[model samples]
Target: MQPKDWQKDFPVAEPQPFTQPHELPGPYGPPLIGHLLQISSEQSHLTLERWAERYGSLFQIRLGRSRLVVVSDHKVIQRILEQRPQSFRRNCVIEDRFSEIGINGLFTAEGEDWRRQRRTVVAALSRTRLASFFPRLKATTARLQRRWEGAADGNQLVDVCRDLTRFTVDVTMQLAFGVDPNTLETPGPVIQRHLEKIGPGLQRRFFTLFPYWRLIRLPPDRALDRAVKALDREVEVIIRATREHMAAHPGHGPTNFLEAMLMIAEHEGSNLTSADLLAHTSQLLLAGEDTTAYTMSWIVHYFTRFPEAFARIRREVDDLIAPAAALDKLEQANHLPFLDAFCNEVMRLKPVAPHMALETLEDTEILGCLMPKGTKLFVLLRYAATREEHFAGGDCFDPERWLPQPAGHGNQPHNTQAFVPFGAGPRICPGQHLAMLEIRAVLAMLCRNFDLRPVSHGKEVKEKMAVVMRPDHLHLRLKRRSLASSVPTCAPTAMAASRSGASHDL
Candidate 1:
């Protein structure tokens, strides 16, 4: 009601004179809908961007009686991110809905339950394992490339989003757990359909009329139940298969993520149950597959929007990774400047999802305002990345902003404190290292062998959000790139000065 009133409603350890949490400006929208329709699942980030412009970033909106405070300021985001398991927890409304379906994995678990499971995950997905995992990643991307090559031969349009989805699912399953769920090879991919269902269903969970939709026998509720059942069936089978394989190969040192986790579970005694194993496997599969896929799709989407940028990226891939030297031969290019910058730019512009919802563990102070326990806090990731204050030409596709600055240049580039595509702080994504390699592999292979020709060239493609955000109308054909372009055209500059190339000029 007043600038000072919300602080009294939400007392914290220490509070300063600031606007009441509720008094923070926002388009509250209708009482029931609460901007739900305005920011529909089809383009939530776009709507949020519009609101962020209107409300000046720090604002609040209601979602089914839950007061959601959206933070686009990088410093505020930094504050919330630092308060991981102790002060802020995963959003209960979304996480609880997942738990109800018996999928309470690391993403949902809080307190020590989260910490313990997270340690296991980190250990399983360690960097050493990625060397062994790289072959699988390359194999999966190569397989998808062959399929696209076939499509290019016949003048067929490729569903880049779906293919990337299949590719990531194939890679994620094998690399994470050493199973071949081969959605890429399957004609009518059952698991892929189930995986696709989850994003939309998860969206429904966050923005529906009633928060407790499982209590209601609505269409969305029934479909979500069916989707979970199908997903459970598929994932549990893989868990059983992994268990059997581990048993068969006794005394084997941990090879992939599953084996590493199994070893931990065995040595750690009875703390890790079979159900916990199954739940973690499900979480890994679901989280790993879609997030990587759609982010890559958005990368492709950016390339389509800016052809010259795409040409420069393709040139970088061609010269650097040409003839695609064996994974074992791959070197210190982990810091491949241009490639890294391109991926970074894509994530900044189009993050895996628009926002990550966190719930407060205790009464916490955000931006000097008290937020009582159970407050719904949204890290407006897309907004922060696109804000004029945080970035120069934030809406423009400029990867150079991520490149290292040239020597003797007395200039500060854009602020990147808001760049948390894989998240930050202690609870940052465990699979992030592996995900980067996977992304590099896909980007290199696809760009080297083919030119992405958008089917609807020059038309605006909107984002479809669920658990992951993807292009709603993206279709491209992989027309083979000539060997001439594959050959080094210009001596590549240090990526710092590479901005002299046409990235900004275009």
Candidate 2:
């Protein structure tokens, strides 16, 4: 359908009070529009938390003409995500915007199509495959270290998030397309621009008082359309290059993820056309890049905020690689207790994907409340994570909360349902393991090399939720640490040293 006709078909509905008997009540707005304008403009999770406290955990808010059910109860979210995958698909706004640039990959695909794509992508991102890809990850980390060194020397206040985004984008591009776009050194192509643009656009659509069909047609800006076209063109180029390479070489090179997909197409005697390839590649890039980078950035932010935790991590890195001169010893740094706790705490406090939207496929009852088919549900993950009832000192940035108590000690796994940073269910993030590895490795190196402090007024850095929960601006003053002071005098393993090259020295 053409964009205009599509808009007409999905006409904006007049807002009304939620009619369902089981729906929890929320503050309503004027006729034909609901609480959407209020909810979207303010912090959503905070708004939902307040409503839950007032009404209950499963409250209804009118999103345009649509009724959205927001749920923070762990049991309810788990059941919806795990037991009712079919009943809950991607929310309408996400599905529509992502589709514009051909994003029907595992993350957004549904039913049998989702299952097939997920199976192939998951297999490729499996533990064994990730281990093989470690060398590439390590290489990228090395390059990042060089970048950091240059920044430190120039006394630049680096936006750690942007740098990490570039690094992950580079890695995802290499892993998925076998082509290094080198976005780390330069601004990304049109697709990259769209990747950034589409996120805020989707967020706006989600919160808008009008349906997306109406919103997109009204000419505020054609930036979104332009971005979509740019993304499409970039993906098209990659698809064409892959096809040419396969036709010319035909079974000559080691099979990568793209090659594996192509092989499946060839064996099935199906022409897995360029569009399919473009869509899947776009999916892979979107899935792999933003979440990982955001997670890494959050970890750094938390480390800087909680200096004790930061100091402990630095000490752990030092102990793991006793000899400051031996970079190989850094491998042992991965096993440090404090480092693990710090990363977990960072995820708990600032989950990268704080809110996930799911749609109900059929009538279902959650927590004794009946939800009709096609209901939109917002899974409030970060609010769940930080609830006072979920953790002792829940609002405090304490890494020790994640650590195990000594044999006779008191701390046990705090039973909480709010900690689902990666989401829950059969459709949980497939790239989680790889993401953890990247985060842990990069964070380990960062602590070992730099004495990082937030900018003088940086303590006020508030998080603004976009596609990910990211700090609006993270300005860190990095002082390169002396190797001898940071690490012990012990000899390190060759691998660790090679990875933490002289670039670490400011």
Candidate 3:
């Protein structure tokens, strides 16, 4: 059978109410697989938004034999994620796969394990630590600049997604394992192939809810097993080298994140095991690389689509590093208001993780709705971000929405909960600060060095949901912009600039 054919075999049912009429807003699902078919199809986010329009913000859908509550309302999401964290836990099916591989990292772990891991990560990724890592961030951005310059030298229409992926992978590898994957100069096929495979595997596991699938497990694919072994062996080598170095120089250690984890492992006096260290390090590599890279791709895509935003970003960069020779001043050049707003706007529209899943640990009442224990919940983050009620010009890419206004000014109400690109609640992404720093630095450099425009023949990039939200086949043409020109040649036309103030352009 073809991969998606099984979806057709599942029985579909009519929508029913899972809770009282006045409690939650929408109709529930049918017996087995309710609205699962509708949601699992292509561009599910848009489909969910349409459903939200029909059935209210909070609704229910059935996936195979499982029931899932879809929450798009900001108040309900905040309450569930923050006010009642104990009532919700990471989805078991998703967590179990990671636990099986000795990876009880924060993303997959639960309860005390999750809390400890989060605390450790938060300490390592705090604002102070991120500031300390600026030198490394600058170095990676420099490498990407060189690559972009070379690519544009031949006037080639390059895949910005591919370039961003390589750059992010290189930066993440260095930060996590202190090993340069050389994805920029020489891409590592082993790492790239395995990273791609992991996402599909995860998605398949997420879709399969029956316990029998795990019980009647078939033999593992030999090629995939071999790739896993190779990756594990590489990680082991790095761990061993780090241990040997720490022992030889005791107290004098590397300044990178991996070394910091090692120090924590020692200080914890047996609570932090070797497996824990390896798992956290690997998690960092996985989470850090693709998410940020995809975000940068979307940022570039938006800039191309809305050239006024691009021009604003370029102007910000130019002002920060005038004379175009202030390479050393890059670290101190992050105060650009428009650049910050632009990044926030991109995140608002194209959140890297579009859907976040949580499972109920106990029966609970949310906004007067009684939810049964074991019911899975998927917060439709992207849909919430695009709703007209939350954003003034819902579909348009407007950076000005994030700008701070004068006190008591009756502008559009700013709703941060509706824009959860890095997530909300105590379980929010710990690496958020580091990720933002990396994105801001790379985007700042790109805007300064080159003029980004969409490829004439390439299709307009739209959201493609994987482990991260990425642009599907985002091909962009780069024109090398000269700092010598007082008026940037690639600045948007007057009409294009004015359109950003309009509603629903996206």
* Colliding pairs, model 1: 3-20
Q: Ranking by lDDT, best first?
A: 1, 2, 3
Model 3, 150-190: lDDT tens digits are 87898877877678877777777776566777766674364
User: lDDT of each prediction vs. the true structure?
Assistant: 0.72, 0.68, 0.67
Better of 1 and 2 by TM-score: 1
Task: Give lDDT tens digits, candidate 1, residues 230-270.
Answer: 98888778777878988998998876666777788888775
lDDT of 1: 0.72
Clashing pairs in model 3? 16-28
TM-scores for all predictions: 0.88, 0.86, 0.83
Model 2: number of backbone collisions? 12
Q: Which numbered prediction scores highest in TM-score against the true structure?
A: 1
Candidate 3: C-alpha RMSD to true structure equals 8.1
Error of 2 at 142 (Å): 0.9
TM-score of 1: 0.88
